[model samples]
Target: MKKYTADENRYENMQYRRCGKSGIMLPLISLGLWHNFGDKDNFDNARTILRTAFDNGITHFDLANNYGPPYGSAEKNFEKIFKEDFKHYRDELLISTKAGWDMWPGPYGNFGSRKYLIASLDQSLQRMGLDYVDIFYHHRPDPDTPLEETMGALDQIVRDGKALYIGISQYSAKETSKAAEILREQKTPFLIHQPRYNMMDRWVEEGLLNTLEHEGIGSIVFSPLEQGILTNKYLNGIPEDSRAATEGSYLSESQITTEVVEQVQKLNDIAQSRGQSLAQMAVAWLLKDQRVTSVLVGVSKVSQLEDNIGALENLEFSQNELEEIDRILKKD
Candidate 1:
């Protein structure tokens, strides 16, 4: 409850990348409020995490309407933390939030309809107590709704001054090209794409990264740690209190087979050789590619956040290391 002042040398050690061809520059590591910023979590810890992120020059904070367990709690909690610590530094920060997933119960509460997208941003803005978010994203592709309607709503949001720029998440390469075309026709600033990319999951490599590069749209990847599987936490086995141990979590025990543990152990050995934690190595591996504008990282503790930030120390990989990583991942 004391005052907060950001570090004077915050930007000295952190790295920034231009988001696609945009005028905005995002930190190499951005903080995500997907899990630990909810109402059920510790408020003081969450506040400390936010402060730690900002103090370390992490200017971009990503959130979604349905991020919290009860939905909308993350934004509400962020509002309190922002009002206390970050209100004065708003200009120095780039805050983003998304819609397009299941937010509310009714027909208008979900999907890509203009009504849903527009209303969702209003609620998100209200929850976060902000006049406008730096960037707003459609959380996913709504299979039932037309893509034009969804992209059109995003265009409208920018026109209405509700959001500065628009983005999309989890869209395929073809779909991304189409959406980019629609936004381009309208001259809307479709700035970034939020995809799930990591050492474990390479779906974006199929065509999505190339598509983003061709279309001149940036990407900030989520789940770069593969729901914590890419880290050393699972090298031995799933801990009793780990996400894999919890029922109904996104990562389950079944996903962590003996083979997966072997792979993680091999990865951990490689990480130790590089003088980095497994989590740090996993994150640095993603940044090795220039197309990755930023890597979205989520953490429960401030130390974890700092560890992720430490990935900036070594973002390079030799051909041998790259080949070894490919061999490890491609092994049956």
Candidate 2:
């Protein structure tokens, strides 16, 4: 193990909240290695962001087996850092990784089959330079694979001490209920469910929120800023360095139409009334539901992270403000 030291004192401003009924307490804001921190990007900059996140109370760093431009590069980069400045601070961190998406070229490289699931986690563990990850997630649902096989693999992971908990991402309410029932029967803790939720996207409000609340499972919504569309960066037009002009598979030109811009402007008016930017207000909005344990945020630079971290300064949203926002964005 490499020698390192973390400022155990910063735990003061850093708030850790319980994940629903589970005893696991995660930091209010978690950093995600979804776009940056890959071999295709600058390693030094990634290191800076990771350290900055740690310095600013972000203890959880989320990654997956296939988060990079060329799959597995994100985990490989994280493993390199874990072997360097992060080995000794391992106990102080909540590093989570996932599988179940398309990884390698072969059939065994993807999905939730026991063969694929277990093997993918093995690769993740090896790439992260750890015997186990605190949270292991199934990236998406598998329609063909039996839920029992997936649950069994998760059970084996905990039984063998390879993962402390198992989570599901982008799962529908039906699948979530089914998985929760089986896991509860086997005395397994379904820790968290990650979903793409934001002011622009209110799909989860239909039923997913009630499902998680009823089942007592935790939720950490991603894309809460809608890939930075809520920010003032696009008020005029797409800047050259924005995610739109970059290699973004999620945020593209087709998404930024006159209608989206108008809705964003109307929402911005509401955010300004609250004395917050649209991005900050959006982040604050997600935390309005106490059921949401954390908001997984992605950034391209330290300044972006700093601005995002400032969202904690103001989290309150009044009923009228929410109603006005709903009028404009609920249908968008």
Query: Backbone clashes per model, in order?
Result: 0, 0
Find the 10 residues in a row with the least total lDDT in model 1: 323-332
TM-score of 2: 0.95
TM-score, every prediction: 0.99, 0.95
lDDT, residue 308, candidate 1? 98
- For residues 137-196, write the lDDT of model 1, one tens digit per residue: 999899999998999999999999999999999999999999999999999999999999
**Which segments of model 1 are wrong by more than 4 Å?**
none
Give the top-scoring candidate (lDDT).
1
